[model samples]
Structures are given as structure tokens and as C-alpha cells.
Target: MESAIRITRETEFYQGYIRFKMAVTNESPYAVNEVTLDFVYDDELLRVDRYEPLYVEKKGKLHLGSIDGGKSKSIAVYFDPQMCSKGTDIECNVAYKDYKGKRYIVQMEPKEISVICPIFRTVSDINTGRLKEILERLPHSESCVFEVLSSFDMFKLVNLSREVIEKRNVKHVRTLYTKDKTNYELWYYGKTKVNDDNIVIKLSFLAVQHTVELFAATQTAEALTGLLADVGKDLKVTIESRVTGKGRFNLHLINSKITGNTINNLLDQCNMDGTCDVNIVIDNINERTNAGRSSVNNTNFLNEQEEQRLEAEKQALIKIEQEKQESLQKEKAEKELLRKREEERLRKQREELGRIQAAEEPKRKEEEYARLKKEKERQEQLQKEKAEKELLRQREEEWLKKQKEKLEQIKTAEEAKIKQNEAQARLRMEQEMQERLQKEKAKQELLHKREKEKAEKQLKNKNASTCQKINSNNSKSNNKMLMFVVVFGILVLIVFFAIIPAASSSEQKAIDESVKGDNYYNQGNYDSALQAYDNAIELDVDNSTYYHSKGTALCGLGRYDESLDSYNKALDLDENYTAAWTGKGYALNELSRYDEALVAFDKAIEINSMDAQAWSGKSEALFKLGKYEEAQAAAEDALDVRSFG
Candidate 1:
């Protein structure tokens, strides 16, 4: 029921190795079949080699298995310090499980682990057999979890199940999985172990890209190494390893060229569009049965793409069908118009016959008696027929007029539709062009910025190199000038002493003391220099130079308290001594007395406003006191002064 693993012996070796020891006591009635240890370290430099007796799978994974409860086991593994970049620390964790499938941490220990320092000169400078030796002698601890992931890659720790009667016969472990931004998925089975009470398994998956943390809940290195190898065959990189400890001390190195990035990218590629199912199983040694849990889902990228493609195809089909419909409607409208015109012609002929018949019928009736009566009746019949024909003609004419109107409306509608389609197409084209141009402009701007940065870095390096050369030359010139001055002074002193009355002994002694102090200070003998300066000040307390010299020496000796007092004395003697104020500020700042340091720097700035050092000191003091904005302002002020000066 306890959360953390207990440490029997957790220590780091000097040879860049870690050793962990733990007691696997089985408190339950069920026997512990197996124990697994998972070791993790930060191996950035890849200083560990393949042939160093370290067990690493081809995919940069290691697995160690077979630890029993009520039994104590020790694991030792080496880490290559050369593989670690400067400032990176190494750490590890241990996991324990019982045969009855109950899981818990080892009873006694701290979770936090410290990294051991390596022999820097041998690996960084010498570099010969260094990796092998270091790997063999790595110090490890069972107290905490050691996580040794190299880069962000797609990997999964899977617990494989062998179907058995009992549900408790499942392994416990954690696997890493990763997918790239593009969403591609990969699957790999690492390694697994079945022991008396506990089962440890490792599985590698090639989907979901992320930086995963290694925890104690993970299985042994042996299982993980095998799983990585399975995944590595299809991937650009893989991790393989051999297990040591209850999977605690992983003396395993990676045999993988697959960078974390490559794995992640592949995962992204896989997940970009599809359904993926990742299954994990837990097994218990006592029951010989394992239970499995599966997670399956469709990637959002896939669903989105499918939806987009479907929408696009649907729109295209609709557009094509609409065009066909419009064509059919146009042809039908033309046929209706032609039929209307033919009907109109027939109607005109019918109206003419009706007029002729009516006129003839009235004349025939007056001419003949019996013959006239018969002829008149026939004429009346003809007139009736003509009237009927005239009515049909008018109906035909009305139908023709309606058909003409419909034809005109169709023509207008077709033209308007065509115009609207053209306008929309034109707008889409213009928008696309604008977007392309904007993208091009952005790319150009990015290129320009990168070029500017490169040019600036080059210029800075050139200036730094030039300044170093100039400084070297100046030092040589100064030495030559000093030699010449010393020689000339000796000659002048001999002539003056011989020609004039000798100076008083006190004046001579004072001058001698000042000369000695200057010599000692120049030679970096700060204590001696300070003593000599004290003597000089005793002889002439008003001498500001003596106080300044003493303050400079005290500062060099790390006597900031004494140095601040001396600088203040020098300032009292000469209020305009800018150098003394600078020294005092520096000393006070060293003592973390920022307020006083600020005041001293401010005074120096007032005396000589263009002094960059005084302004810089003020900035530093402000920064230390958590006044970042003020610090920035002060720094800017110093830069302005330096730039202008």
C-alpha cells in the first residue's frame, strides 16, 4: 500500500556509474514470481558506447528481469559522463510487485536521487577507452527512479498479456508513446518477463509524439529493450537495453540512431488521419492469467481531412449537376417558343376565312327563291364554321404571346446567372493571389531577419577579436614605456641628488614606502601592498592616493568591509575622486549592501556623468535587489553614456 520503493543501498560511483540495492520482501501469502527494475538517466552526449559490456537493444532500449520477493537484489550500471552535456544531472527509480499481483514501492527510501560527477579530463579531453570504463563503473541507487530518456520520440510501454484462467496474472509497467506534429502512428512490442509472482513487460508504440517522464511504475530494461527493437525495425531510431536490479539499476545503454524527433515526426505522420488502437495488458505470475485494456480512437486530423474531402467532392458534383440542369432548361425554353410561333400563323389564316364567308352568305339569300333558300342555308353553315375557326385562332395567338414572354425571361435569367458565376470566380481568384503574395512577403521578411542576425553575430565576433589583439599590443607597449621611464628616472635622480641638497630623510622614506606599495600591488601581493600602504598613510594621513591604494588592495584580498572604509576615507580627503567612489560601490555591492552601493555609485556618476563603470554598478545593484525595471533603465543609461562618450 506504500507509494515509494525502499532503498537498501543507493549510491553513485565515481566512475560515472550508479548502483542500487533493494530487498524484495513478499508480505502477501502469494509468492513473488518476478521483480523488474527500470533505470533512467540523462544521456545527452551519447558518451556510452555499444561494446562496453552494457546490454542495450538495437533500438536504444534496455531490459533486466527476474527479481523475487522476500529476496534482496543488487544492480549496478555505468553511465557515460561524456554523453551528458555540462550541467545535466542523472537520476533513477525502482518498482516492486508481488506474485499475487499486488503492486507497491520498496518500503524504505527517498525519492530524490543525485547525480555523480565524472572524471572530466579523461572523457572531455583524453577520450580513449573512457566510455567503456565509465559504463562499467556507473553508480546506482535503489532509493529513487532513474530516468534516462535521450530525445523526444514516439514510444509506448505496453504490457502484453498471455490469456490465462486467472485475471491477476498481469504485468505492471509504463511505456512511452509519441507522434509527430503531422500525426503518423507506429507500433512496436519491446520486451516482457514472467516470473514466480510478478510479471514485467515493455511495449513500444510509434504514435503520439511527446517528451515522456520515466517513473518507477515502468517495467524492467530487458522487456523495454525487446519492445524498442520491434519498433526500431520500421523506424528511424530505436532504444534497446538489458535489465539490472528489480529494474532499478539499468546498466543499459542505447543502441539507437533514432532521435526522439524522428520518432515523433513519424508518429505525427501516422496520427494525421486514422484510427489507432493501443492495448496494454497486466499479468500476474501466480494466476498465469493476464488482463488487457485497449484504447482505440480516430485521430482528429484524419476525421477533419475526411470531412473536408467529402465536402469538396459533394460541392463539385452539385456544381456539375446544376450546369446540366441549366442547359436542359435552356433547350426546352427554345422548343416551346418555336411551337408558339407555328400556332400563331394558323390562327391568322382561320380569322381571314371567317370574314369572307359572312359577306357572301347575305347576297346569296336575296337572289334566288327555292334555290336561294338552300344556297342561303349552306352559306349560313359556312359562316358558322368560319366563326368557330376565328375563336380557335384567337386562343392560339394568346398562347404564342405567353410563350414569347417566357422565352424572354429565360434569356434574362441565364445571363444574370452567368454574370454572377463569373464574378464569384474572379473574386476567389483575386483572394487566392493576395494570400500567395502575403505568404511570399512573410517568407522574405523572415529571411531578411535571419540574415541581419547572422551579420550582427559576425560583426560582434570580429570586434571582439580585434579588441583582444589591440589589448595585447597595448600591454607590450606599456611595459616598454615603463622600462624606459625607470631608466631615465634613475639617471635624473643621481644627477639631482648630486647637484642639490638631499631631501629630508622623512620625505625619502615616504616616497620609498609609496614605491614599495605600488610594486606589491602591481605584483598581485595584496596583503603586502596593504601593509605598505598603511605605513604610507601613517606618515601622511591627508594623502588621498595612499588611501586609494590601500582600498584597492583590500578589495583584491576579499576584505570588502575594510575596503569600503578605506574608499570612504579617500573620498573624504578628495571629494572629487571618481575612482574612490567606484571602488567603494564595488566593495559595498560585494557585501550585498545594495543601498549603500547605489548611493556611492550615484555620487561617482554625479562627479563624472560619462563614467560607464559607475553606471553599470548602479544597474547591477538594482538588479540584485529585485528592481528589474530600474536595473534595465540604469543599464540603458550606462550604455548611452558609453556610446556617447
Candidate 2:
């Protein structure tokens, strides 16, 4: 036979109820007989009293009255978990006995049990008699006696609870002892019952400490006896208190006296024992009421009175602070109300202003149009006057050109006349040359004779080699001076033409490219316009306006990434440029980088809040990021700018 056990939580922790189930399967060879199922668990922290049983087939059939081998039956168990906290796990075991008197333990998988603490009170029927009052005072001391003796600090008593004792695992229970006071040991007791359906479980606990001098006197002992008898009628308190002597001191209720004179009689009875009996009840009352009264002095009393006054003053200060806070809150609320009213009034004024502006816009535009028409006519007139001035200047240039041509012709004619005069002079000089040549021919004949004679003399008297060397040296010096002048002239010309022109042309190209790109961009041929703008930037990378224009063109082309890059370039060139920041935000929004777009928009707004495009772009980005609230507010902010669409 197969049997299964199931543990389930019935009620929550506060209700203290838990339930279980048992099931048996039938597949055995023998005939079925009676079987019993028992559910067991750890009843330490919590105890269960009753459980319902299983009812199988009727009339003692094959599977009735008991479970045979290979036969199945089901049973249940119910309990309470009154002390269990949430998520506590409890385990249960089940065993069954068949009709053949063979016991079989059920093998089943373990199940996890959870207990939820409910809001209801745990104990239903609490016996609040004399014993109950003593049990309620089980955990008595506010602070640990040992820790207080060691540290002498009262701070430990503040915010102390059961958690502190449990954390420290403090085993010693707290109780007060007095040397001069009478001994009346106050003990508390509690009891718990489990698995008893006949009676509800009630726990009565009494705490008794073992000490040498407890109830040392007969009168005190008698007082303890009378107190215990009046506490419970059927209370069975476990007494662990120590006896003063070796023998166990047992009190018989029938022999005990109950009158106040019984203490006096017990003292007299103990007179031969050399100990005077004292009333413990009176001692306990006095001890509790006059705890520190014996140590009071005049100085201490005055200090205490002053301390009380200071404490009262402190309390007054706290109350004043609380009142101040309340008043501040009230004033803040009032200020906020006034501010909101002012804002509403201002908003209405702004709305009125917007309406007025809207109503005046067309009239203003019409007047502007008339003014523009007049301005255009005036510009046309100015252009005509400029054209006439240009024509007059051109005519003056023609006259100057005619005069320059006439002067060139006259100068050429004078050059011809000078050439003619040079030819006539040359002819005359030839005639004189012929005459002089004829005379020189005669002189040469004479010179030739003198030279022959002088040569013959020089051949005998002079050194010819030295004179030829001096002539060669003079001719080389003249040739070197002429080459130096020619090289210096060529170097000057090369510097002017190559190095100077290269630098000047680079600068001129940069300026010209920027100007041309701006012209093309302003004309709105964005394709060629962007090309020109890129060319301008290539010539001068630091040109912010060129980058701005390129970014604008890229945005127009729907190339948001490139546009963002270009705008970033512009910002790098000029950090304070509002146009670049606004453009960058727009590009980021186009790419759906809403967070970055908002940051860029904020920067642009900081630079200039009147940037309508930035406002609108920020509104759109905020809307897509699940910030519909902010989006609506931002959209309203955008409409506040006149240029926002």
C-alpha cells in the first residue's frame, strides 16, 4: 500500500492554526483492514491540540474501516501555529497501521510551510487572576542590572526591547534585591497544552530563582504562603525556590493562618531561632515606592529641582520649535497662495498681451509693407543715381584714355625725330672720322716707327711676363663683380614671385571661399551651397559661420548625424554661439537621443531663452521619453516665445 502525507497551513500566525492531509493507495495482495494515521510535528515553539480524522469506505468493505496492502485511504490533521512568524517552515510525519496490526510509516516528499502573522490577538481565553498579574510582570527591569552597575549610564535603557535580550542571549533574569528589606520572593508561572481536543491549552508560567536567603524569616515565609493560596484555586505551580535550611520547607494550606496577626505570631514562634520575622508584603510596597528616597540630600534635592526646571524649559523650547515650524509652514502656504495668484494674474496679463499682439500683427505688417515699398522705391532711386555716377566716371575715363593716347603718339613722334637727328649726326661723325682716320693713318705711320724703336728698347730693359699677369688679374676681378650683381637681382625676383605670392594667395583664397560659400548658402542652392560651405571650412577650419551654414544645410538634407557633427564643429570654434547649440539639439532630437537633446536644449536656452526652435525641440524630445507632464509644460513654455510654431 502507498500512503502520502501532506502538511498545509490552515490559519495565519495570529490565528495559530495549521492543517495536514494523509492519503493511502491500494495495490496490496492482502484483504483490507483497519488503519490509523497519526500526524506529528515539533511542538516546542507552537503546540497543536485537535485534528479531524479520515473516513473511508463504509460497512467494513475491502477498503473500509482500515487500509489493507495495495488499498488506498485518506486522512487529515489540523493544528494551530499561534507563535510562528511569517515564512516559518514546519515539518509533519504521518504513520498508519493496517488491520493486520502491522504499522507502516508513510514515505512522502517534504513540503515547505509558510505562516503569516494576522492582526488578531493570539490568546482567546486568558485567565487573568492573581497568577496572571504576576506572569504579566515576567520581564520587569527596564535596563540590565549588571550593565547598569558596570557603566552607570542610563542611555542603554532607552529603546531597549526583547530584541536586545535575544541578541545578547541574556540568561540571567532581572530582579531587585534589598539587604535591609524583608524577603518576599515574587514568582510567576505559565503552562501550555498540546494535542488535547477535550480542553483548550492554557500556559501558566511562574519564575522562581534559587537563592540562599530567600524568605529567611518565618513571618516573611508566612506572607508568601498566604499570597500564593489566594492567587489560583487549581494552580499547580512548580516551586524551584531555595529553602533557608537543608530540609524542604513545604507549606500546608490547611495549617496556615490568614490574619495580619499571623505575622506577629510567626515572629514569636521563630524567637528561639534568633531571627525576627518581618512582613514581606509591607517591605515590597515600601521598596517600590521609596526606591531612592533614602539617598536624598539638600544639595541633591535642589539639583533635582533645578533639573526638573531645566527639563520643563527644554519641553517648552520643543513646543516653541514645533509652533515655529507650524507657523513657517502656514506662512509658506500663504506665500505660495499669493505667488500662485500673482502668477495667474500675470498669465492673464500675458494672454491679454498675446491677444493684443495677435490683433495688431496684421496692421503692423501692413504698415511695414507700406514702409518697405517706400524703402524699395528709395533704393531704386539711389541705384539710378549710382548708375549715373558710374556712367559719368566711365566718360571721364574715356576722355583720360584719349588724352593718354595723344601723349603716347606725340612722344613716339619725338623719338622718331631724335632717331633722325642721331642718323644725321652719325653721317657727320663718319665724315669727321674719315678725316681723322686719314690724319691718324699718318700718325700711325709715325707711331709705328716710334713703337718699333720703343719695342727694341723695352725688349732690352722691361719684364713682359709680369705686365701680362697684371692685365689678366684686372679682367677677372671685373667679370666676378658683374656675376654677383646678376645673381642678387635673380634672388630678389624669385622671393617676390614664389614665397610672397604663395602666402598671399592662400590668405586670399580663404577669404574668397568663405565669401562665396556664404553667398551660395544665402541664395538657397543648398546642394552646391553645402559644397561651397565645406570648401570654405576646408580653407579655414575655424570659421564658425561656415560650419553653422554647413550644419544648417545638412539638417535641411535630413542628415542629422552629419548636421550634429557640423554643429559641434561650430561650437568648438565658438563656444558661446547660440545658433550652433540650438542646431545641435535639433539634430539630437532627430536621432531620438532625447536626453542628450534636452541637455543641448538647456544649454541653448541658457544662452538665449528666446530661441523658439530650441523650446519646440525640447518639448518634442521630452514628450517621447514618457514625460507627458513635462512635455505639456515645455510645449506651453515654447508658445511663450513669439517665434515658436
Off by over 4 Å in 2: 1-490, 493-501, 510-524, 542-544, 572-576, 607-613, 623-645
Task: Single out the weakest 10-residue window by summed lDDT for candidate 1.
Answer: 159-168
User: lDDT of each prediction vs. the true structure?
Assistant: 0.47, 0.46
Model 1 TM-score, 2 decimals: 0.23
After superposing candidate 1 on the true structure, give the runs of residues whose Cα lies further than 4 Å from its correct spot: 1-505, 643-645
Per lDDT, the best of the predicted structures is 1
264-362: candidate 1 lDDT, tens digit per residue: 222222222222235322112212222453433333233556547645644554465468557746754664476458446645654565466457646
Steric collisions counted per model: 112, 27
Worst 10 residues of 2 by lDDT: 140-149
